[model samples]
Target chain A: MSSVLRFRDLTLGYDRHPAVHHLAGEIERGALLAVCGPNGAGKSTLLKGIAGVLRPIGGRIERMGCEPRQIAYLPQAADIDRSFPISVFDMVAMGHWRSMGLFGGLGQARKLKVFDAIAAVGLTGFEDRSIGTLSGGQMQRMLFARLLLQDAPVILLDEPFTAIDARTMADLVDIVKRWHGENRTVIAVLHDFEMVREHFPQTLLLAREKVAWGDTRETLSAENLLRARRIVEAFDREALECTRAA
Target chain B: MYDYLIAPFSEFEFMRRALVGSIALSLAGAPVGVFLMLRRMSLTGDAMAHAILPGAAIGYLLAGLSLGAMTAGGLIAGVLVALAAGAVARFTALREDASLAAFYLISLALGVTIVSLRGSNVDLLHLLFGSVLALDEATLLLLAVISTATLVIFAALYRPLVLETLDPGYLASVSGAGAPTQLVFLCLVVLNLVGGFHALGTLMAVGLMMLPAASARLWAEDVTAAIAIAMGMGVVASYAGLVLSYHAGVPSGPVIILVCGAFYILSLFFGRASGLIRLFSGRQHLEA
Candidate 1:
C-alpha cells in the first residue's frame, strides 16, 4: 500500500525537550492505525505533528499525496471549551471550513449535509441545543458528526473515546470502520487496548520512541507492552539532550 | 411623564450629545464585550482599559485634554499593552493573564503619576470619570466613526472570529486564520475601549463593554443573539442612566455602569441560559 504519511526521524516537543523523540514511521493509505502509549508517551504530540499543529524539531513529516487541509484532526475533548455560545449545528457545520473558506455561506445542500451528519450521530433533535448543554458522550458523538462532514482523506483522533460511554464508543467505532471502508487513512491516539485490538488493524506502540509497529496482534504482544512501559517509566526527566543517532 | 423622560435629551444639547455618544459606544463596545466575555477575557478587557490611561495622560500633558490627542494616545497605549502582553505570554513561561495584569498595573501607576504632574484633582477626576454630559461635536463624530468602523470590521471578521474563539486548534488545523483573527479581535477590543474612554472614561469603560455582555450571555444561546441583546441592554442602560443622572443629580458614567450592574444581577436569576434559577429547577427536575 502507498504511504499517506512518512515521519523521518521526527522529534516533537515543547522547550526543546522532545515528547516524541526520533520517531520514524509511515501511515499507509487506507490504513486504520491505533497509536498506543502510556502517560506522556507523546501519542498526542505525534498526532499533532502529523496534523501540522506542532512542527518537528529534528526531522520532517512528509504528506505523500494529501494537502494539509485534507487532514482532519479531532483534538481531545478537554481542549475544547463547551460553554461557548455555539449550537450543535454550527459546530458540526465547521467541518465544511475548508470548502467554505473563511466567509462562505451554508447553502441548502451544505445545510442538508450538516443535518444528515447530526442525525447519523443519533443527535437528530439536538440541532438547536448549545454544545454546553450536551453530555460528555453526546459531545463526543457531535464531534464525530463534525468529522463525518470533514470527509478528509486523512483523519487524526486524539483520545476520542476518553470519558465517553460504551454505546457512543460503539457508534463512533462504526463511523471509523466506515471511513476505513471508504479508503481514508485513520490514525488515532488511543489508550484502550481491547478497543484497539478489535477495531484497528494496524498498531504503533510508542514510549517516546518506537517500540513496535505493524499488525495489531503482534505489535500489542505482552513483551512489547512490557518493554514500552519500562522504557516510559525509566525515562529521565532531566536528560539534557537526545543522544540517539539520526 | 413624556416631558420628564424627553426633556433631558430634547431640551438640552449636552444631554442630547451624551445620549448620542453613549448609544454609539453601546452599539460598538457591547459587541466587542460579547467576544471578550466569550473568550473569558473580561478581566483582560479591564486591564487593557487601565493600560490606556498612561497614554491618555501623556496626551493630556502634551495637548491639554485635546480629544484627538488623548484618543490617539489611548488607542496606541491599549494596543501596545495588548501586543506586549501577548508576546510575553507567547515567549515566556508566564501566562497571558499574569502578563496582562503586570503590564496594566505598571500602566495604571504611570498614568496616575503623569496625570498628577500638572493637572488638578478636578482634572484627574474628569480624566478618570470622563465628561459624558459635556461631549463636543468632535468627540461625537469620533464615537460615530468608531462605531461604524467596528460594525464593518466585525461583519468582515465574523466567521473567522467565531471559529477562532470556539475552537482555535481546529481553525489552525484547517487554515492559517488563527493569528490574524486574534489580532483583529484585539484591535476591535482596543478600538471599543478607546471609544468607551471618550464617554465613560478609562476606569469605567470596560464596565460598559463587559457587564452587558455578561448579562446577555445568560440570556442568549447564540453569538449573534447574545451580541444583539448586549447592545440593546447597553443602549437602555445608557438612556436610563442619563435620565437618572439628570434628575438624581449624580455622575452619568457611574450611573450607566450601575444600571448595567442591575441588568447583570437581574439576569443572574432570570436568564434562561445557565442562570441560577434555571440550574436549580433543572436539578429539581432531574431529581424528581
Candidate 2:
C-alpha cells in the first residue's frame, strides 16, 4: 500500500509544551491503525495535528495526496454541546458540508444519501427529533451517521467509543471496519485495548514519545506496555525544550 | 376601550412612532437574542448592552442627543468589548465569562462616569430610559432600516451560524467559515443592540431582546421556532407596553420590559418545552 501520511519527527502541543514528541512514522493508505496509549499520552493531540486543527510545534505532517478537506476528524464527545437547538437530521446532514459548502443546496440526491446514512445507523424514525432529546447512545449513532456522510479518505476518531453503550459501540465499530474495507485510511485513538486488538490490524503505542509502531501483535506486548507506562510516569513535568535538529 | 387603546395610537403621532419603532426593534433584536441565549451567552449579551454605554455617552456629550452620533458610538464600543473579551479568553488562562464580566464592569463604570460628567439629571434619565414615545422621523427610519438589514444578513448567515454555535470544533475542521461566522454573528448582536438602544434605552434594551428570547426557549424546540416565537412575543410585549404606558402615564421603556417579563413568567409555568407544568407532568407520568 502507498503511504498516505508521513509524520517526520512531529512534536505537537499547546503553549510550547509538547504532548506528542519526536513522532516519526508513515501511515499507509487504507490502514486501520489504532493509537493506543495511557492517559496524557497525547493520542488526541496527534489526531489534532493530522486533522490540521493544530500547527505542529516542530517537525511536519505531510499528507501524500489527500487534500485538507479529505480528512474527517471526530473529536471527543465532551467537545460537542448536546444542548444546542438542532434536529438530528440537520446535524447528520453536516457531513455533506464538504460538497454542499456554506451556500450549496442539499439537492434530492444528497438528501437521499443523508436519509440512507441515518437509516443505516438505525435512526430512521429519529430524523425530526431535536438533538437535545436524544440519549447518549442515540447521539453517538447520529454522529456516526454524520461521519458516514463525510465519506472522507482519511478519518480520525478521538475516543469515539467512550461512554457509549455496547450496541452503539458495536454498530460504530462495524462502520469503522467498513471504512477499512472501502480502502479508507482510518486512525483512531482508543483506550479499550481489547477493542483495538480485535479491530485494528496495526497499532502505534505512545507515552509522551513513541514506544512502538508496527503490527498490533508485536507492538502491544506486555514488555512494551510496561515500558510505555514507566516512560509516561517518569516524564519530567519541567523538561526544557528540545534543541535537537529534526 | 377603543378610545383608551385604539384612539391613543390613531390620534397621537408620537404613540404611532413609538409603536412602529418598538416593533422594528423586536423583529431584529428578538432573533439576535435567541442566538445569544442558544450560545449560552445571554450574560455576555447583557454585558455588551452595557458596554455600548460609554460610546453612546460620549456621543451624547459631543452631539447632544443626536441619533447618528450615539448609534455609531455604541456600535464601536460594543464591538471593541466583544473583540477584547474574546482575545482575553483566547490568550490568557481566564475563562470567557470571567473576562467578559471584568470588561463590562469597567465599561459600565466608565459609562456612568461619562454620563454623570456633564449631562443634567433629566438628560441622564433620557439616556438611561429612552425617549421612545418621542422618536422623530430620522430615528424611526433608522430603526426600520436596521431591521431590514438585520433580517437580510440573518438569512444569508442562518446555516453557518447554526453550525458554528452547535459544534465550533467540527465546523472548524470542515470549513474555514467558523471565525468569520462568529465575527458576523457578534456584529449582528452589536447592530441589534444599537437599534434596541434607540427604542428602549441602554438599561432596558436588553430586556426586549433577552426576556422574549428566554420565554420563547421554554416554548420552542428548535432555533428557527425559538426565533420566530421570540419575535412574535417581543412585538406583542411592545404593543401592550406602549398602550399601557400611554393610558397609565408611565414610562415606556420599563413598561415594555415589564410586559416581556410577564410573558416569560407565563411561559415558565405553561410552556411545553421545559416549563414547570411539563416537568411536573412528565415526573408524574414516570411515576404512574
How far residue B48's Cα lies from its native spot in candidate 2, in Å, is 1.4
lDDT per residue for candidate 2 within A172-194, as digits (tens), equals 99999999999999999998989
Q: Please report how far candidate 2 places residue A11 from its true position, in Å.
A: 1.2
Which pairs of residues collide in candidate 1? none
* Stretches > 4 Å off in candidate 2: B282-288
lDDT of 1 by residue, A142-225 (tens): 989999999899999999999888889999999999999999999999999999999999999999899999999999999999
Tens-digit lDDT track of model 2 for B182-276: 89999999888888888787877789889999999999988889999999999999999999988899998899999999999999999989999
lDDT of 1 by residue, B90-188 (tens): 999999999999999999899989999989988888778888998999999999999999999999888888888888888888889789889988998
Q: How many residue pairs clash in each candidate?
A: 0, 0
Point to the candidate with the largest DockQ: 2
lDDT of 1 at B28: 92
The fnat of each candidate, in order, is 0.68, 0.73
